[model samples]
Target: MRVEMEFLGSGTSSGIPTIGCDCRVCHSANPRNKRLRSSILFRVGEGEDERRLLVDVTPDVRMQALRANLSSVHGVLITHTHADHCHGLDDLRGLYWGGGRERLQLFAYPESLAQLRRAFGYLFDEDYDYKGIARFDTHVFEHEPFVVAGVAVTPIPVVHGNMRVAGFRVGDCAYITDTNEVPDTSIAKLKGVRLLILDALRRAPHPTHLSLGKALHIAQQVGVERVFFTHINHDLEHDQINAELPAWARLGHDMLRVAIEADGRISTDEGGGGVAPLAF
Candidate 1:
């Protein structure tokens, strides 16, 4: 099977070129240095039969969708309901308004869903006066792989400080963001994944997100040859970090498209470098 993953937003909560910051990465002219909040999109199949699953609904979702020319969002897979991750819940109403779906399909852990409901009460609340097509059919998933648009997505549970969140495995690629610890049980599920898009927040150790060294260690434990680190902070410069990494790894920037095959082959095209959609 072939799957394409697009990095809609690859930066941390505050994003790169953070406000009031005078860092070198912030001042850099390279497009790769620029980033939005963290989120990604998965694509499978083609034409009318195509399936798209969005992971996370970052605050930057509107801009991200416009940049990717996102056509349809068949489903949404949320890791957790942190402010940065789920703040775009309001922005996604437009998808339902414009698309053909009667109700948007969304999947997340039970607690994550609860948090989202509390945060965006009107979306799930039945008493609201606004009777719009922007409602959702929320599906709660646990450890098992759930089907989204004919694709089986396995939830890989990991710990972020004191809270539990999920990373997902779809086909040969696994996308995990906002994580610091992947327990042995969770790490076992990632053994055969050809491509891993993971969290590498900064150079220094963090309580919730993985540091550069720690993320690399986790990658080694999983034994994935090609890895794209996401949820980056301004501390690491794009080019300098890539130079320091092993050839199989690179710091993913906003709009990076990665293609992975079932047999472990991987190819990538930087968005600013060129147009990189295989099936779109």
Candidate 2:
């Protein structure tokens, strides 16, 4: 099966062009410099059998969905319960507006799920009698493989400071974010992935987020065919930083879309005919 992935938002928690901050990258003219909170959309299978799986429910999910022409989201795979990553849980009520009462499937780690339920108790309340609360069928998984909407998903355990989060692998692509380190066991799970979307906050080292240098090293160690860095900060200018990266790796931007085949081949709009440099 062929899987299509769309980068809904690629910015860090604060997002690019951050509030009231006047930095060079924040004031840059490049459209790629503008980013929303980190999130991604995955379309698996084809035709009617195709299922839309969202990676995170960022605060910008409403606008992101509208911009991407998203109609329905079948499931959501959360990385963690950070405000930037899952605060948009409320907006999912809109998706259930016209589609009847079909409950959406939500997959996450136990800790993350508990955080979400605590944060959004109203949405999960079965007897709240609320008319517009987002409805979901929640499922929890640790470092194991499970099926979601017929697509197999493997959770990759990663460490983000003192917190443990999950990254997911679907088909030939793996999406990992908000992490400073990937243990050897997790690296083994990602050994042969063709496409990797990783967290690369900035050039400077962070206690919880992967620095650009560390992200690059991880990409090289994994030896993936393509790498797109996400969870970016304002310290790096899109054009300048991207220009410095090798052809196999580049900074990921919102709205960027790529197609991956079952055999691990990847193609993007910027790459016509053959594999081209990662841009846009």
Candidate 3:
């Protein structure tokens, strides 16, 4: 079995350029630099069957999915109920409900489920016909192991100020976003992970996000063989920041992909032709 992950988006709350500020990285013509909020797609495959899982649905969800060429989404595991994490959920209607109307499955915490229901009652209201008209069923988490698409997922708990959010550990890869700190219990669950996708907003401290230094510290604590930092901001340029990280730690880019094998080992698929780096 091989599990693959694609970085759907890797920008902060407002994304790059801030909608008005003319920062160099934001204004740069590099398409890779053009980010669209934070999100990712996790896929597990065996032989010819592939199961796809999505994490977060920022306001840019529709465009992001289209750019990634992902036609169908199997499930969504929300990290938190923040607007940036759940706003684009309505777009799922296009995929979830088609000519026949099929509902999507959403896995989230109890509080997050409540917020989603309240904010988008039209999706829940049987009478209301959404512009696209999609339906979704919610599953509550208990910070324990659960199964999605036949893959076992262990929910790693992290604190966002006073609120608790779900960070998932699937196979040997853990994807955690919007987290400043992971408690001991969660840290225990993340041990020996081959690849860790962590929050590294910037170099400075933040109230609810892990700075570069803090993210590195947490990665060290988790002792993952290869750690990739996501949920970044324009402040951390991709090219310059890679030189600052350890050999096994790098800043994740907008389209970076990682593969985790059945034994929980991690690597990247370079389109089957490039030479892989040798360990020193």
Candidate 4:
């Protein structure tokens, strides 16, 4: 039951090299610093049975997909309905058609789905005309375990600002993004997880996102074998931060691939400039 998770984009809302900002990380020569909006794709299973679950379709999703050479997407899981997390959803029309599926399955909490319905009335509203638009068959889950394409997934509820969002645990890894706090109950749900991809917005604290110090604290509490910080802002330079971090943790970058084996072995590419899907 091993699975692989790929950091499609690791930057915060504005993304790296954000417009009009002349910060050092933004202009860093290292490609790792050139991050896009936060998102991840989980490859569950292998060969023909493989299912790729896309989490948080950011505004940069199109570019991220192209960079990763993702030939298809099996399903989409939204952490929340924030603009950066789900804005690029419409851009996935081409993927839906290209994958030759009748409709893409979308899994999210009730509140987020309601927001999606409002945002994309054309896609979900039965009253709207169905021209040639790609459809998303929405599935709702709330603080429970669900299955997608035969893989079991546990939803971990976390607080983001004034709202609650979901983080998912599939196999041995749990991904929590854009959340400043993970409740004690949710931490209990993530007990056996060996790998954690948690949000660490920047070196400084933010109201809604976890700061580096807090992220480290949570990772220690989770007692994960390894952790990679995501939802990064440009304040922390990639290489410099890694140099400062302990052996168990490092800042994640765009296109980073982490593979876990059934026996609990974990391996990574440091993004290795991203490897194309096997279909390529």
Greater lDDT among 1 and 4 belongs to 4
Candidate 3 lDDT tens digits, 115-167: 99999888888777545668777788886788886878888889987898889
Each model's C-alpha lDDT? 0.86, 0.87, 0.80, 0.87
Model 1, stretches more than 4 Å misplaced? 131-133, 261-264, 271-280
What total of clashing residue pairs does each candidate reach?
A: 0, 0, 0, 0
User: Where in model 2 is the C-alpha error above 4 Å?
Assistant: 262-264, 271-280
Q: What is the lDDT for 3 in model 3?
A: 82
* Candidates, ranked, lDDT: 4, 2, 1, 3
lDDT of 1 by residue, 1-280 (tens): 6688989989999988789889898877777878889899998765677788999999988788887888568899999988889999988877776566468899999999999888889989877888553689999999889998798999999999889988999887899999889999999999988789999999999999999999988988899878999999999999999999998889998888897754546878853542323211
Number of the top candidate by TM-score? 4
Better of 1 and 3 by TM-score: 1
Better of 1 and 2 by lDDT: 2
Ranking by TM-score: 4, 2, 1, 3
lDDT score of model 4? 0.87
Q: Which numbered prediction scores highest in lDDT against the true structure? A: 4
Q: Comparing candidate 2 with candidate 3, which one achieves the higher TM-score?
A: 2
Per-residue lDDT of 48 in model 4: 86
For candidate 3, give the lDDT of residue 113: 90
Tens digit of lDDT per residue, candidate 4, span 1-280? 6688899989899988789888898887777888788999999888888889999889988888888778678889999999999999888877787788568889999999999988988888666675567688899999779998788889999999999989999988989998989999989999989899999998888999999999999999989999999989989998889999999999998889887976768988874655323221
Better of 2 and 3 by lDDT: 2
